[model samples]
Target: MTDLKRLGLHDLHLSLGGKMVPFAGYEMPVQYAAGVMKEHLHTRAAAGLFDVSHMGQVILRPKGDMASLCAAFEAMMPVDVAGLAQGRQRYGLFTNETGGILDDLMFANRGDHLFVVVNAACKEADVAHMQAHLSAVAEVQPVTDRALLALQGPLAEAALSGLVPQVAVMRFMDVAVVDTVFGALWISRSGYTGEDGFEISVPDGGALGLAQALLARDGVMPIGLGARDSLRLEAGLCLYGHDIDTGTSPVEAGLNWAIQKVRRTGGARAGSFPGDARILAELADGPERQRVALRPDGRAPMREGTAIFAPDGTPVGSVTSGGFGPSVEAPIAMGYVATAYATPGTPLEAEVRGKRLPLTVSTLPFHPTTYKR
Candidate 1:
């Protein structure tokens, strides 16, 4: 096998009994000796530290003014970039001409510039896309000197505040640069898990130290990819290549809320983005299919790629993300199905293995979110 890239906390991960696995071109921990189940439950009850350095960090500085930069960015996607207030972060997507999503991302307006985080597998292409499109109005700089860490769960604030008391005042989606002994931490009070947490970007030199310190705190344990996947799946958040991709439109993926009113038809800045015609049309009308939450009938989890069928055995959709939610203690899944069958409590069948299993369309986030809004 070819060598895989390693995170800055590679050694620390091994020392913590992390079982490393290849993921998104990196040798990341799938779970520690505590196992995926314990880690998942711990994260929901207390805090779990995750090493996510494989994801990309980028800085976009305006060549002219912040307004120009935001305008240039808004052209690439249907999001209202210019309206994002300072010190706050918002979820965004990059779309192709057909309104299919290229990649989903998070961008924070950090005063004069924008700080963005993209999926690990799409970072290179995302950065290139930004450079090719926004080069005339903004300087797109990829950050390579920082390692990102996510401290997640209910006790996340207490664990993080132990080191930096300033974090205690931050609300959900709040971003700030706080001085720490390790370095200046660029932190955001956000996470993919349906829990209160923070994502911290620390310089490479201080990554291991900060991770170690966080682990040293009571109720904080090292979490890995296995639990991370389950956590996000339970949260009903779409996984880029799986639940969403270049073939999926935001509206079909249940992400219309991410597309603000200003970008919709009849709004002030409507229809300039790629695929705005189809996207806006879908908004006005409705998508042929829609992403929905699923509750499997039995203990078995209907994993990704599992085909969904109507009660009459007609093919309807396919499962994108699925697994047993530790907190919910039940099998949960998210997938796209015919719009008519996407209603909550609607009966559906998933072909797991060969036999069809019963399932129901349920409300999103099988587990409720506890974001500190």
Candidate 2:
């Protein structure tokens, strides 16, 4: 096996009792001493810290203004990037010619340039694709000098408010570059756990110190990937390789909102991206299969790859992501089911360990997100 890459906080995580595990080619923390269950609940009731430096970060600088930069990105993404306002962030996907998602990303318009964050597993390929396609339109610079940390949960704002007072005023999806006594912190009011929180981008040298300072605050504790996955599942968020991939289109993945209406077939920037015809068709008519939330009856925990069946025992789909949600306190899952059977409360069965477990099509999220919108 190849060696796992270490993030800047490798040593710090060891010191803080993080149970290191291989993830996305990195030696990441799967759970700390708090364990996945407590870690998951802690984030819901209070706050938890996460080291996400393994994810890719980059800055897109255009030869012209932000409009040109947006146009540069819009060439590959279906999002109406050119229309993004300053300090606002949008979730977008890198789509292939067949309309399948290459990777999902978060990009913020910083007034002068675009700041992007991509899933760690696909970042290498994502960056290479952007460089090959966007070179002529903009400058793509990878940000290796920084470490990313997510402070997630209900009291996250209160914990970090002491260091950065302005953060308390920021609303969901807002981005800002704030200066602290420690140094410059590039922050975004966002997180994956269906909670109000911040993703802080700190210089590599200050990563450990900043994390320590944050953990020092009341209700703040270090969390890990195990809880992160369970949390996102409860939020009905897609995990790049599991819930979405090169074989799934954005519309089929239930991510239509990511594409602004202005970029649709009749809109201002229509037909400007890969798989435009097919994607627009699916958007108009709806895809045959749609990703939806599934709540398994009882406590069997319908895991991924489990076959989903109709009342008559015909296979209609398979679970893409599944697990027990600590916050929801039940077995929750998300998968692509035939559109006819995708409505909420639709009865279905999930084949788990050779037994047919009852399930229902439920509206996401299993738990409502408490973003400060």
Candidate 3:
């Protein structure tokens, strides 16, 4: 049996009758006693709190020059790191030599330090890669003592206003150092779900108390991995290992906006990252395959690993993530397919349980996002 690692909120989850499951090496709650459907509806109607402490949090500081550190980091990602303003965060991908994604990460400029959040499963490899390539002028420190909590939904602000009033004013992608009843922490107006929310990074010891305080509110409920997956899928957000991997580039993942034009144009920092040639080529001519959203005709959920077929019934790709979106009232999925069949409104079929279900290519974020900004 594999030893399951527990987060700071493990006891809280168990107390709430959480259905624990092993995920990304952690014993995480897949759903609460209220069930996935109730948790999903709660998040959409009000707020759902998630314990994301299993994710890796790292702090990067420049040994001497911040600009040089930014440049060094930019060489590994396609995002415009140098242009990131203080207290702002951007989603980025760490690409390998062939333009394949190592992991998708969030980079937040915290004035004197840079805060990086990576996938729980890929954290070790990501940190090693950073340490191996970062110049002597930069120091990479892992913040294992911290815990991350995401409070997502329309009522997120209302739930948090009593604790941190400034969080209500912060726009999407904005970060603020707030002095809460617990202690000093970094609260970012962001989340995985396509809703207004905040990601709080706090001292590990204080996480449980904070989570309890949040859940004590009227609109807040404890959510789990199952609902988190469903919410991100409904929002059209990519899951690190599923929607993208070492074999997929940002271009093919429908994440071209993450790459800046200045980085594409050769200059001081242009074409410095690994697989720049292939990435630039794809940027110009488009990728052979592209990630797309799909809507199945029936109520049955199309799950990951389900085969996608062309009009002739030949395999083209496979579903990466799928489920019934409570907010959308239909089954939604995301997958990679040949570029020719990736257009919106293209007719396709997903083979589920030896049965081909009629499907069609559709625009992502199956539901409209309600971001504060």
Candidate 4:
């Protein structure tokens, strides 16, 4: 087998006794000596720091026409890119020609440039796609030397307030460039753990120091990939290769809020993205399948790829992401089922280990979000 790639924090992780596992081609900690259950609870009650440096960070410089560049990006994405205010970030999706999602991403306008964060596994292909389509109008630079860290949980504010007070004042989805003891960094009021937190992009060499600083706080703990997945799932956030992919559309994936009505109606710039036809069609006439949250009865956890069947034993869909939610104190899952079976309160059965577990289709965000704003 090929050796797994390591991130800048590999040594730090190993020293901390992180349980390393292969994730998106990188050897990362799926949990630590504290265990997944403890790590999961720690993030909920305190703060958890995650090393997300493996994700791609790119900068887009619009040379001649910034408006045109923004429009070009909007054409490839479902978000209202042109309407984004400076220092604000928006979640978006790259749709295929058939209206399926290529990937979900986060975009932020940093003063004179545009910054984007993409899934680690899809970064290369995403960059290639952007370069091939945007080279004529913009300069796309991949900033691989940068490291990203997520400080999440209720205590996150207290942990970061001393270093960057401005971060405490910012609302969710807001981004700011701040100078800290570590150095100048980009701090965004964002995170995947469904808690109030910040995602900081720092210089490669300084990442470890910043992580150490956060870990020194009273409630701060170094979290691993296992807890990160469970936290995001409890928050109803989509996982790239699972909850969303090239086969799902932004609308079908329960991400319609990301698409502004103005963009859908072709108000200012019109439909310029790849799957405009299908996307607009879905906008008018709903999608064939829709992503929904599932609550499984009993203690057994339903995992990804578990077949979901109608009450009569007919296969309708399958689980995309699932596990025990530490916060909710129950098993939670997400998946796409036929539109007819997507409504909240619908009853379904998940086949696990040859036994049919009763489940109910429910609204997403199993736990209440604690974003600053």
Candidate 5:
């Protein structure tokens, strides 16, 4: 097997009892001694810190300024890049010519330039794609030496205020640069766990120190990827390559809100991106199959790739990501099924061991989001 990369906080994770495992070509912590269940609950009740350095962070700068940069960048994707205001972040996707997703990402407007965060698994391909199409107009630079950390949960604001007091005044999706003893940390009021939190980008040399400082604070604990997955699942967020992929469209994934009015069918920047024809068509007419949340009444958690069937044994769809939600207190999953069967309270079955288990489709965000906005 090929060697795995270590995150900047790898040693800190070990010292804090993270059970390390390989994920996204990195040696990541799957869980700590408290385990996935407890960690999941603690994050809900208090603050939890996560080392998400494996994810990609990049900066896009134009030859001149932000005016034409947004237009040029907008030509490459379906989002309203020009509409993204200063210090604000928006979720976007790189769409292929045929309406498939290249990768889903979050981009923030930083006054002078754009800051982008993408999945670790797709960062290389994503950067290559940008370089191929955007090289002539803008500089696509990767921030390879920084480390990203997520401080999430209800208590996240209070816990973080001690270090960066001004962050408490910021709303969700707000980005800023805060100076600390270590260095100027690029901090954002955002996170993946359906809570009001921050994703802090610290210098590589100070990642361990920042992580250790946060861990020493009350109500803050080191959470691993295991809890992170379950939290996002509960938040009804998609995990690239699992809940969504190159085969999926933004419409099929129920991400219509991510597409703004300015870029839709008849608007000014309409039909500018790769798959606007199909995406707009899907917007007018719903997709054949749509991603839905499933609630299995039993305790056993069904995993990804589990087949779904109707009560009469006709197969409907399959599970993409499934697990026991420590907060939901039941087995929950997100998957695609026939549009007709993708309604709340609609009954379906999932084949677990040999027999089929019963389930019902439910609305997303199994847990409510508590963003400060």
Candidate 6:
């Protein structure tokens, strides 16, 4: 644990009775004194502050023109980078030559440059990938002097707006750099908890102060990674390395919505990025298996690696992400199954502890998302 990196709020988490554990090379808090169940419920009802600083923060500065930079970036992935408007953010994926996902990320078109956020474990490789590919048109700059914090829930807007009144006007996916006493806050109206919230990047020096101020609010509580995982799972969002990875394609992972039509086979700018052949083919002709939402019959949670079986005892797929959804009050899961069984209400069985347990394919998002659109 000594070799693991620590966030700026490490001491603050310890003070709040957070149970520290290793995650993505960081010694992060998995749960606080309130436990994962209470923390999960509290965030759905109120606001939960999360320390997500371990995730990578990066900037892509254009050398010539924004259009050229976007073009250069588009060469790496099958996304419509040029179509993104300023002051807005969108979900993105880094794909390998074989059309498999290297990582999933969020990028914001910040007028002059792009602000990108990648998962903690893939930061180094992601930065290197960008530099290796976009060096001619953009400067890949890694931001290391900031801490990222997420304030998420129904009350997030009320709590955050109390300190920074300007943030109240921001809608979902809106990104802005607001000046505050704590310093310039690069804020995005988005989060992974399927709630209305903001992801704020504050200077390292002001990280603790801003966290303390937010925690001082009436409904804000300190949340840890345990609750974070459950919250995202309930939302039906994919976690990198688990639900999505280098072996999975965006089309197969049920992320076709993220790829705008412009990049499709018949669209204006079609078939130029890496793995375009395979990705576009998958788009035209459906994939063999697709990611789907799963609901276990009883209270027992079917964890990851649980294999799926057909009605006649034929092997199908396996669970990628699964857990007891605190909000849904039932064990929920997400996995890839034969496209034939991906429909809603399709009966199936999960091999949990070597016994076939009944389950069903359900629509995504075990719980409804309350984003402020």
CA lDDT, every model vs. true structure = 0.95, 0.92, 0.90, 0.89, 0.91, 0.95
lDDT of the structure predicted as candidate 3: 0.90
What tens digits encode model 3's per-residue C-alpha lDDT throughout 107-203?
Answer: 8998887889999999999999999878475788989888899999999999988677888789999988887767777899999999899999998
TM-scores, each model vs. reference:
0.99, 0.98, 0.97, 0.97, 0.98, 0.99
User: What's the C-alpha lDDT at position 264 in model 4?
Assistant: 80
After superposing candidate 2 on the true structure, give the runs of residues whose Cα lies further than 4 Å from its correct spot: none
lDDT-best of 4 and 6: 6
Which pairs of residues collide in candidate 4?
75-273
lDDT by residue for model 6 (298-343), tens: 7779999999998899899999999999999989999999998899
User: What are the per-residue Cα lDDT tens digits for candidate 1 across 227-250?
Assistant: 999999988999999999999999
lDDT of each residue in 1-373, candidate 5, tens digit only: 2599998888888888989999999999999999999999999999999999999999999877787778878887888999889999989899999888999998999999999999999999999998888787789999999999999998888888887788989999999988898688999999899988999999998888888888888899999999999999999999999988889999999998988988898888787898888999999999988999999967778899999998888889999999999999888999999898998999999999987888899999999999998
lDDT of 2 at 367: 91
Model 2 C-alpha lDDT per residue in residues 259-330, reported as the tens digit of each score: 888889889888779888889999999999999999998887888899999999989999999989988888
Global Cα RMSD, each model: 0.8, 1.1, 1.3, 1.3, 1.1, 0.7
Better of 2 and 3 by lDDT: 2
